[model samples]
Target chain A: MNALLTSAVAGLTAAGAYALLGVCAVFTFRLVAVVNFTGAAIGTAGTFSMIGFISLGVPLWPAVVLGILVGTLAGALIGLVMTQWFSEATATTKAAVTAALLVGIVALGLRLTGGQSPKEFPTLFPGSAFRLAGVEVTVASVLTVVLALVFTLLADAFLNRTRTGLHLRALSERPMAAELLGVRVRILALLVWAVTGAFTTFALMIIAPQRSPDFMSLSLLVVPALAAALVGAFRSFPLALAGGLTIGIVEGMSSAIDGISQYRGILPFFVILAVLLWSQRGARWDEAR
Target chain B: MTRTLDVSGLVINRAGLPVVRGVSLSAQKGQISVLLGANGAGKTTLLEGLSGIIPTSGGDIALNGRSVIAARAGERARAGLSHVEQGRTVFRQLSTEENLLVGMAPGADLADAYDLFPELLNRRGVRAGLLSGGEQQMLVIARSLLTRPEVILIDEMSAGLAPVVVQRLMAAVRRLADAGLAILLVEQFAALALRIADHAYVMRRGELVYDGLPQPLLADPDRLHHLYLGDVQAA
Candidate 1:
């Protein structure tokens, strides 16, 4: 019973990180009508940033802040390119930009460590555990879940309660009308990028320390996060959160199923693809907006 | 009543093809100027050019003595030129109130839009996509009013609307003009255009073929039939 509870709690923590990443993906997808495949690359970039700062003898506090700051800057730069250079750019062009960014960032990661094996990441939270209902839950896991909830709530509030958020939604839904209404369409697009970038960076800084911060390992988070976003049909915050948690739990549960762990990598793809195909029977990207 | 818009030798090209050729027109304060044309007559294109949404290949658009052809859409709007484009281009997903709010700048009085079309205020929280055609037109026109533009360019204000709705829209146009807003109305309906226009210009194949006062143009049935209406016998 203790083992089962601990597994579930750990699964819940992983879900929180997935939710954070998923929300950012949804934000970008809704605003620009493009799925960001390179989102994980941005996370990897943040991890490198954190480690780079730490290597320079900077304290952990400043290093973390510096990492998040770099992430924010990355988001702003990506947003600028998408909005200004690609205002009238085609769908294919936007996708190309994200793909290029991902490749460039990953290449930068290999170059930064000079082919040395990637090291264990520094922790943001104390690696301590507490027992709840006979379940041992780590401090990092609790913090991840709490932070994810906080960010998602704040984002939801920002979208539903603020005038600027309304304008941004208008810009996303019908760009031409928003423009006529004097809403700055280009700026809104850039803003979406900035917000997504910041979130991706923060999420990476929080999670990268638990695993290898190599390009492939970090980039794989895109699949689950994207699955979370997809399951939400690109809307509904609660659903996205639930979806993220579900993926994380499923990922955890699969580990206990005898030889199923060997095929764990293949399960998410089949499950997500099937679920998406079933749910999105007649949905089109343009019609949603 | 003190607004004026003057377009001189306005040349517009789309994809290297000339759409409006050296077309010069004007709308004086408290006056309604109508541009009458057949399908693809470059009527909408000219309005877009004046509003700064479309790039003009040549010529000048001056709103109250300030050149606006090269200005950005928002800048031109700030300079007191508003456009109600051919399509009732309201933000469809936004609630009626939200759509109106978007057009109402931070500094402007939103109540004026509601004053012009009180029905929009009634359906304030409703999504704009669900509004009736006439209601959508009213909302769009009312929203554009937020800019308090000296010149209001309306394209096909009557298209796809019921006759009574068209009458209401035309009446609204008249009221705006009476309040000193220079209005450039582009329409396909000759009778409707002539009803409120102080002056009218006829376009055929992207060139201005006739420019004159409304009464004389309306009275000459034979000339009108040959130039605009398909046939007198058919009418």
Candidate 2:
């Protein structure tokens, strides 16, 4: 139906945001061995802080920059803890630490923002760019798609072509070996976290206005992002981008059906579950990478 | 002889248990000092401690007559101590050429690494993980060489390889020593290692059970077997 097409087109913005988050997840996990469960929560905190800055009558653009810096700082702090204490820890241990941090940040985020209350989430880009299938296409939607593609292209090039990228790839695959080879593991890890932090927050900020934005709701964007990451096996950036867009389109199509609209949030969880089971179909429970 | 790398009373602990128990050894410039031991004799631990990959509980590590005890793993590497760790820890996703470039010195040439392991040059675009075991070992050794270290610590270079590949790698190690770099080699093959070694050491239960010239030990198999009694399979 025409309604389904409109909804699918509308989902493009969320798809772009999901792609960005997925790319970030891939980047961090590849370079630093961190399965960051706090990706969305960190962005939520930063976006709320930007809203706080705007409420104080400060200009919107400066507040956005300051908020992104906060997110970067949050990521840097997490990186510091992991690098200092869990530098040699197994991947599971690192993931557990981030999961604990996510829970803590969620508690803090909810307490600060107040529960279930929707605030005015201002849009950086407003107004529709064009029309398609009797539906208006927003400039923000087009911008987000472009941003996702640009990030994917840039990340692929950096990981393959640059000296730091080679060092990062080396560090990710073999941490102890990288250190013995004279790569500054701690510094590079912090840089990866900071960059991803800035990206995730910006991704969420653009899409906030179109959604029913609450702290908990915003923090749970991690589900789809996680699904997107799973699609790439936390290794390939282009695969992650494609996965993100697909999940967003599916969610949009699901929203077109009244019965599934309320349960749309759980759609990503199912996707994540399906991906996990499918990827490990023939592999045994004891199989390890 | 000028010692390029020196460790005295080195102690490394894992899970609060001392793995390298107050071990002392030295590697002189332009010479190969072979350290032979059983699987659990802590040869790898000692090398890791010496290279600063793991913290030494108590010890003094001096490189080029200067104490490097305060340095971290990366600092030790930059200070000319290269560790080609066991398990052939090449970055799995990176290409063969990228592996060499990752830890190379500022002015180090990729061509030199390629020349050392000519087998790797043909597989420049291949991911390290996809390389055969022999080629991976070659890549790791070549990578360490690209760091331009004064002293290199190579642990178990022949872990899992064909005997011919092992022979080729041992020859490469000898060539590296001949090129004026101090080499501390921990190996499984006693006879092959001893053939190219100037000095020899045998560790048992975290202690140096034998320390002297390689000629005497190479001439006596019974004594070498006795030193490696715990792990009878080591040759």
Candidate 3:
């Protein structure tokens, strides 16, 4: 049906954003051992900064570059604080710091924007739609899907083929052993944080135009993203992407149904709970801790 | 004799309680210095302090005649110190080849590691976690060997290994020492370690109580037993 095809395209667009965010979240968690609750806020800040620069008459490309740079620096600052300033802090304390950072960055973004009102986010992609198999498909939607695939492939290659990527994987597996083997834990941690920060921003740039580019909504997008990461057990990139797409499709399909559509937002919670329960069923006490 | 590693007046405190106190020793090139002690005697703690895994409260560590007391664990490793920690601590998720790559110095070939442990060569593509205990030990040792370290601090190398595997590892370690690398070994198997050790020190409750050639201690079981068990009657 045309309705089914339209929803599928819409689902793919949403899936691209969710998959990017999920990959970033999972990568950061594996490398730094922190959940990085501030990821969405950092992306939201970058998106707003790009829009502000565009309004100030800066060229779109340069403004976009500056926004990404700002996001990267912000991520590095957070990493420095966590790895250097609070290196000896417990895992619980470090996680609490990330939560606090989420609040702080969101507040800072609100102050910078002067209000929580929605701003028109710009898109670099051309505004065009084409009829495909009797359903309308936007160019942005197709571009987003392509970009997601390309980024995933690039990320996968970097992790599997590069030397620094091996070091990252080593650190994720056994940090003490990796350190003893001469992996620079601090520098690598900073790099992971910076990359994820920039990546989250890039993903937001694509997704922001599709939603209201406001502080709360943009920041809360991390909820579904996290659900996707949890679905992958915070390790597998391909699985995380698949999980994101599946969630997006389910959400899109649910909206077409009658009575249950009101509870669409609660979908992530159910997915998170189910996945966690299933995964934890075999986990020993020591491992679960 | 050239001293490769020297730790003098070393003291380490964990949570305000001294774990390694006033321990001093030196390892010479082409010799194996074994630190023998019972559980909780701080042999592992002393090895950790030397490798910069744990901070030393007081004293100095000079590696190749340079003070490395202020250097971190990774820095010390890059400066030619390697620690094979207690237990088989490989990157379980990484392939055996990739695990070796972690210790491969730039421009150095992994051929030496593979040559030293042929089993690793056979299972190069497999994840290290799937390897048996002895194989994992071989992988860990081979990985460290690829670093071409001047001094190696190995802790409990024989732990959880079969007797035959322990003998094989000891032979490999002896070969390494014969090749002019200083080896500081911490072992729970005191008798087995003494067979391969040149110099020996006994630790009790964080302090060294006996320091002598292994031959004298090995000749006098009563003294060695007293040192390990605290009293002759206890022995």
Candidate 4:
């Protein structure tokens, strides 16, 4: 029972990370109607940059900040391409762009690492065990979980409470109508890209220490995060965060048993596929909230 | 110089076919100039062309002597030619208040908008899609008023509306005109359009066929019959 409880808490921490990435994915997808297949790779690139900067004798704080800023700008460029060049592209073409970008990010990651094996990443938090009611937890994991909650809450409030937030959602729903209503649709789309870039950069930078910087592992991050977004119907942040936590815990618990870790990552992909199939059979996804 | 919209020898094409051919018209300041026509008469097309939504095939549109053949829709809007589009096109996703704010020229008399349509203040937060047809029409008109343009172009304000709603809208148009703003309205409801218009023009197959005072157009049953009532009388 203690082991189960430990796994759940660990899962929650991991869930937080997934939630952050998922929100960024949702933002980018809604802005330009393209699901970014390269989001994780962009994040991994940020992680590698942080490591490189730190190794170059830069302070950890500045390195992390610079890494995040650079990653975010890169993400915003993805939005720019979608708005200006890909605006007229069909769904197939949009998907192709995402696939190409994903491949490019992977190639970029290999170049950054000099084609070396997976290496441990630096962390802002000291690597030490702390006990919370006999539950052992790392400081980095605690910070990740707390930051995730804050980020999700802020995101939800922004989407629902702010004027531009409402405008963004409305533009995504019916861009033509919004344009006729005197909205600058192009600007709004670009802003979404810029903000999501920052989000993915920060999310990757925060959790870099847990895994080595690699293309395959970073790209797979979408599986779990996308599961959370699917749970929210890509409209409700609360649902997305809850879905993230649940998937994290499930993955964590699977690791408690022998030989399960190898297949544990498949859980989110299965959940996402099931949700997609159900939604497809139920109602149209593009009708907007 | 006084505000005037002069579209001279204006030709408009929809899908490579001329819809409005050499249509020249003018609405002087403070006058309610009306366009009378049946469906497919190119009245709406003329408005769309003058508003810069559709590119003019040939001819010229000048507002106070400034040509606008190549201006964008928003740019035209900012230049003081406000179009309350046909079918009362309201942004379904925006709140009524947001719609009003968007319609206002970069800076104009917003207080006049509120005073003109006090009902808007109450429904400011409501998305326009859910409003009743009458309310939606009112909202669209109200937003246009916020721009306080020298010339207001309203197309088919009375279309598909109840008599009472049409009466209220006509009253608002009169109010705007009384305040010295020129109004060019394209309306199919001949009797209603004639009642508010100082002058009226009739269009047939993308050309202005008649131009005169509203009384002559309204009193001539034979001409009116020939213009709009042939089917009703025959049927």
In every candidate, what fraction of the native interface contacts is reproduced? 0.37, 0.96, 0.78, 0.13
Candidate 2 chain B: worst 10 consecutive residues by lDDT?
B226-235
lDDT of each: 0.77, 0.89, 0.85, 0.75
Each candidate structure's TM-score, on Cα atoms with residue i matched to residue i, is 0.90, 0.94, 0.93, 0.78
Of the two candidates 1 and 4, the one with more favorable TM-score, higher being better, is 1
lDDT of 1 by residue, A1-289 (tens): 4554556676766677887777777777776666787777776677778888999999998988888778777777777777766756666888788888777766776777654376678778766568778766677777777766787788778877888888777777766556655667777787787777777777777777665667567867888888888777777666777777777767666666667756766655875797777877667544675
Candidate whose TM-score is highest: 2
Indicate the residue-level lDDT of A5 in model 1.
55
List the DockQ of the predictions in order.
0.48, 0.79, 0.72, 0.23
- Candidate 3 docking class: medium
* Angstrom error at residue B147, model 3: 1.1
Error of 3 at B93 (Å): 1.9
lDDT of candidate 3 at residue A111, scale 0 to 100: 82
Candidates in descending DockQ order: 2, 3, 1, 4
Give the number of the best model, judged by lDDT: 2
lDDT: which is higher, 3 or 4? 3
Write one digit per residue (lDDT tens) for candidate 1, span B61-168. Answer: 888887877777767876788889988887788888887776576577878888888878889989999999999999889888886677888999889889998988
In model 3, the clashing pairs are none
- lDDT (Cα, tens digit) per residue for candidate 3, span B127-179: 99999999899999889988878899999989989999999899888888998
Give candidates' CA RMSD values in order.
4.1, 3.2, 3.3, 5.3
Worst 10 residues of 1 chain A by lDDT: A1-10
